[model samples]
Target chain A: MKARAFSYFRAATIEQALDAHALVGDDARFIAGGQSLVPALSLRLQAPRLLIDITHIGELRGVRREGGFLRIGALTRHCEMLSEPLIAEFAPLLQAAAPFVAHPAIRNRGTFGGSVALADPASEFPAMTLALDAEIEIAGPSGSRRIKADDFFIDLFETALQPGELITAIYVPLFKADQRFAFDEMARRRGDYALVGCGMLATCAGDRINDIRISFFSVGNTPTRVKGAEATLIGSSLNSERIAAAQAALEGDLAPPENDEVPPAMRLHLARVLLGRLLGRLGESA
Target chain B: MSGFDENLLDEADETVRVRFVVNGRKVACEVAPRETLVDCLRNELELTGTHAGCEMGACGACLVQLDGRAVHSCLMYAVQADGARIDTIDGLSESGVIADLQAEFHRRNALQCGFCTPGMLVNANELLSQVAEPSREEIRDALSGNYCRCTGYEAIVDAIDAVAKARNEGGSAT
Candidate 1:
C-alpha cells in the first residue's frame, strides 16, 4: 500500500483549518477523525499533497439543543450521537440507526460531518439527514451558510460544497409529539455497510398518515427521499394497502446508479424488503 | 469507497514530529503524513504485541489504548496521536487478569497459530473493563470485528466467561 508522500498540518480550530485550506486549495484535505481517509490513503485510492487535521478543533465536537432544533457538531462521532440525550428525544431515527453503523470501534471515531460530506449512498446518516429535513451548516472563507437537506447532496460522492468550504454543524428539527420515527437497514454482516437502508418519519392523525418522509439509500447515487411514496401515504390510513402502495412507489423510483456492489435487481429487492419492514413498524407505532 | 476522505487519506507523506506516552514512557518520533498508528507502533516503535492483521479497519487486530479507551489504531494516523497516551498489549502482558486470559485461552485451545490472541485479549479486556457482567450476546457482539480463522469462538468465549466468573467470585483476582 504505497501512497505518495505529503505533509500533515494539524489545525486546532476551524479558523486555523479554514486558513490552511484556503492556502492549500485542492492540494490539501481536512481530516477529522481519519476513520475513512486513512484507509483510503493506505489503499492508494487517493493521494493529495497536504492534510489539515481537524480532530483538535474543539468547536466542531459537540451536540447541543438550541430552542426547537438540535445542533450537532461536524466532528461529533457516531458513538457520541448514541449517548446524546437530545438526539434520543428529537432525532431518535439517528439514535436507533447508529448501532447498526460498522462496529463500536469504528462508530467511536467516524464523525457526523465526515459521513454527510462524503455522502455515501450506503451510509445510514445521509438517509436520516433527509428524513429529518436537517440543515447542513458549512464554513467557508466568507463565513458560514446553511443548506437544505434536499439540496445538500448533488451527485455520487459529490456535494454542493465548494472546494474550500467545510461543514461545521448539522441542525435537525425536533419532531412534534404526534410524529413517529423508524430506521432500518439490511447488511450482510452486523457491522458492514448497509446493502440498502430506509429512514421514515411519519406523522399520524388518528390512523391517517398526515406527513411522511422516506429517505432511501443504496438504491441511488445519493441517498434520496422518495416523495412519491410520501405523497401516496399522506392523508391515507396506515394499513397494508398504503404501505404496499408506498413500497411499490419506492421500488419503481429505485435507481442504484449501476455499481458493482450489487446488481440492479438485488438492490431493488433489498430496498423493497427494508422499506416494507420500516413501514410495518410505522404501522405498529401509528 | 465513497465514504473515504480524500483530504486525509490521499495526502502526501510529511514527517511530523510527535510526542506521546506509550505504555508508561514519553517518546518522540517523526511519522509520515499517511502513516497509520498501527504501522508506527509495530514497525517504527517495535510494539509487536499490537498486531496488524488487516491494514483496513475491518479487523480489530491493531486495537490499542488511547487515553484509557480501546481504539482501532489502523484507522488513526500517527500524527493524530501527538501528545496522546497509548497502552499496547505489551503493557498489559504482565497484569494478572491479562495473564489469566492468556492462560484460559490456552487451556481452552482458543488459537491454532495464536495470531489473533493478543488483539482478541485486548478487545475482550476492554469490554470486560466497561461491562463487567456482559451477557454472552454482548461478549459475542463486542468480539465480532476481531476475527479468528483457526479456532472456533466457543473456547474464546469460555475463557472470557471463566475469567469474569473468577473475578466475580473474588478468587485470586485471576
Candidate 2:
C-alpha cells in the first residue's frame, strides 16, 4: 500500500527540527533514519502531515566518550553498534545485541536511538538499554533533559517524549573491567522478532555476583526487569541450584500476555528457559 | 463524487525536488513527500531491479546501496535521499562489481523465479565485501533478511560459500 501524501522538511539543526515540529504540533513527526516511521506511514498506521527529516542535523551524530559514559548519538545507526570500537570496549552489551537487531540492510539505516525511542516491546536495543542502565538525552523547545531508560518507555510503542521533543542521544555508563554481559533470544527465524529475549549485565567479584541488572523483552507491554530474579542471584555464585531459583522467581516477575500463537504459559516458560540459558552463559564467562 | 472537494487533493499534488547520484550517474526527480526511494527509483529512474516485495523493512527485496551501505530503500522517502548516492541492482550488475557472484549464482541455480535474486545478490555482495571468506553459516546469517521461496536456500548458501573461497584465494595470490 502507498503512504498518504505529506509534506517534508529537512532540518539542518536540532533547533530547526524542534521549530518545524512545534509549528505542525501533533500533525508532524521528527524522522531520523526513518526505519520504523516510514513503514508505519506506508501501512497507514500513522499518517502525519509533515515529516521533519532530522538525518542532516549535525548535532545528532557520532559515538564518543563523555566523562564516565559513552555518548551514542541519536543518529548512530545499528550497523555502527557492531563497528564502533568504543561500543566494543565500553558498551559491549549493545555490540552483542547489534547483530541480532535485524539483517545487515536494515541495520545499515536503523538507528540505535530510533529503536529505543520507538520502544517496541519485541526490539532488542530498548531492553539492552535497561540492562546497561543507559540515560536518554532529549532536546525540545524548552531546552533539554535526560531521562533514565527505566522510565523512558511507558507502553507499547510509547515513550516519555513530548510533542516537538527529539531524542538527542543515549548515555551508557562505560563498561568496566569487572563487568560481564550476555544477550540471547529465541526467534523462529534468525532476524525475526524474538519469541522471548533477555539481556543482563552483571558485576562480578571472584564469581560472586556483586550487582546485576536483568531485562527481558517480548514478554509484555514494556521491556521488563526481573528484579526478583536479579535479587535471587545477587551475592551468590551461579550454580545449577542458583539458576533454578532465579528461573523460579520469573513467575512473580512476568505475566506474559495471553495470545493464540504462543500461549501465556508457553511465553513464561520460554522466559524461564531463556533466563536459565543467559545466566548459564554469564556464569561461564565469569 | 459530485461533492468531492478538489482542494482536498492539493496535498497529494505537492511534489518535492530531489537530486542524487544513482549508480555513478547524477539524477533528479520530483516526488510526493510520501514517495519511497524504491518507488522513486523504479517509477522515475526505471531501476526495477530493486523490487518492492514488502514495503516494510522485514523483506530485503528493496535493498540498495545508499552511500555505500546496503539499506532498505522502501523504508526511506525519496526526499530523505537528496544529495545521497544510491546504487541499485542494475547499477551494480552493469558495473560488473558482482559479476563473479552473479555467475556463481547462475551456475548453482540458486534462484528459481528470480524475484528475490536481486536482493540476494545485493546482500551477498555486502557480506563478501566485509568478510572475504565467510563460512556457510555466516552466509546463511547474512541472508536472514532476503527471503527466497525457491531453491530452499542450500544452493544459495553454497553459491556464496564458493564465491567467498574463490575470492579469498584470488586475493591471497595477489
Candidate 3:
C-alpha cells in the first residue's frame, strides 16, 4: 500500500540537507536512494513528516583510496561495493557479502550508509564495519566529527547518528596483503533476509594468524562482532580443535531476539556453526 | 467504490504530477498520490502489457526496466518514476531477443493463464542479454525474483534452453 502523505524536500547540497534536517528535527529523514526507507514507509513502519532527498548531493557518491585508508562515500550502492576494484583489494569481506544484500533491484539502489545508519541488528554492513573498525564520518550543523563503528550502533535498529547528522563517508583501514576474508549467510530464499550470517576477516603469515575478526548478524540486538571468540582465537594458529572451541565460544557470546520471524535459539545455533564454517573457509583461502 | 474502499488513501484528495519516458514516449500528468508505477503503466498509460499480479514484490508480473535495470514496478512509487526512463513489456515487444523468447514461450507453451507471461518475458530478455547461452541453473537464478505458478517451470526452462541452443548454434530463433 502507499505511504501516508509527507512533504518531500530535495536537497542539492549537504549543508542544505543538514539544515533542513535540523529544522525539521526527528520529523525529517535523509533519503539517499530510498531503498530501505521507502520499504519502511510502504509498510508504515516509519512515519516521518518530511523526507529530505539527498540523492543529488554529489559529495556523497564516490569510492576513493586515501593516504592510509579507503574513503567510500556513504551513498555508494551495494552492488558498487561488490565490484569496486579498491573494495575488492581492501574490504574483501564486504565484496564477498555484497551479493547477499537483497536482490539486484534493491542492490542497485540501497546505499551503504543508509543500511549502516539504519543499524538493523540483522543487516550485513554494520557487523562488517565493526570488524573492520570503520570510522563513520558525520556532518551536521555543528560541522564534522568521526564516530567509531563500535560506538555508532546503540541498539537494535538504533544508531548514535543524531537527527541532523549525515554520515558522509566511511573510512576503512588498509588490510595487509596476507589477509583473507569469507562471508556466509543462510536465507530461506534468494532475496530473503538472513536467518543467520557470519563474516570472517583474518590475516595469516606462516600458518599463524596475526589478525582475526569474526562478526555475526541476526543473532543479537545489533550486528555484533564476536569479540569473545576473537579474544580466544586471534593471534593463534587456528586448527580443527581451536576452530571448534571458537565456535562454541561464539554461540555463548550471542543473545539474539525472539520474534515471529525467527526463534532465538535456532539463530544462535546457526550463527555459531556458520561462524565456524566461515572462519574455517577463510583459514583455507589464506 | 470498491477500489476506493480498499484504498487507504481514499480520504486524501491529493495528486502528484508524474512525468517520465515510457516506451520512447514522454507521458506527463497528475496521478493519485497512492498510485504505483505498475498501475500507471497498466492503467493510465493503457500499456496493459505490464501486468500487476500479487500487488506485492513477490510476483514479477509487474517487472519493468527502470533506468536499464529490472525492478518490480508494483513495489515502486509512481512519483519515483519522474524523470526516469522505463521499459515495460510493450517496449520489449520490439526487442529482437524478446520476440525470440515470446516465440519460444508459444512453441513450448510456457504460459497457461498468461498472467505471468509479461514478467517471464521481461526477466528472460534480461538473462538473454547478459548470458546469451545460459545453463538451466543460471536461467533459473536470473528469473528467481519472478514467480510463475503455472507450467511447472519446466516448459519455461525448456523454452529458454531452446533459445540458448539456437543462439549458440549460429541460428536465430526469431
**lDDT of candidates 1 onward, in order:** 0.82, 0.90, 0.79
Docking class of 2: acceptable
- DockQ (Cα-based) for each candidate: 0.38, 0.43, 0.20
Give the winner by lDDT: 2
Task: Give the range of the ten consecutive residues with the poorest summed lDDT in model 3 chain B.
Answer: B1-10
What lDDT is reached at residue B40 by model 1?
Answer: 92
Give the higher-lDDT candidate: 2 or 3. Answer: 2
- What would the per-residue lDDT of candidate 1 be over residues A115-203, giving only the tens digit for each residue? 99889888889878999999999999999899998999998899988998899999999878899999988888777777888898988
lDDT string for model 2 (A1-286, tens) is 9887787777888877787776678978888888888888889999887778888877999999999999999999999999999999999999999999878888898898889888999999999999999999999989999999989989888899987888999999999989999999999999999999999999999789999999999999999999999999999998999999999999999998988989999999999999999999998996
* Candidate 3 C-alpha lDDT tens digits along A1-286: 6676765555778888886777768877788767667767777888776667687789998999887888999999997986789998887878888877876656767799888988887788888898888899999889999998889988877888876899999998877778777888998987677898888777788678887777788777888888788877777887888888887887668877767778877887887778778777776775
In the range B1-174, model 1's lDDT, one tens digit per residue, is 022234553435446688899988899888886678988998889989888878788888888888877789988888889889998999888555488778778888888887788778988888788777778888887887888888778888888888888777766324
Lowest-lDDT window of 10 residues in candidate 3 chain A?
A1-10
Which of candidates 2 and 3 reaches a greater DockQ?
A: 2
Cα deviation of A161, candidate 1, in Å: 1.3
In the range B87-151, model 3's lDDT, one tens digit per residue, is 98888896554777789899889999999998888877777766768899878766666778878
TM-scores of the candidates are 0.93, 0.96, 0.90
Q: Which stretches of candidate 1 lie over 4 Å from their true place?
A: A259-261, B1-14, B169-174
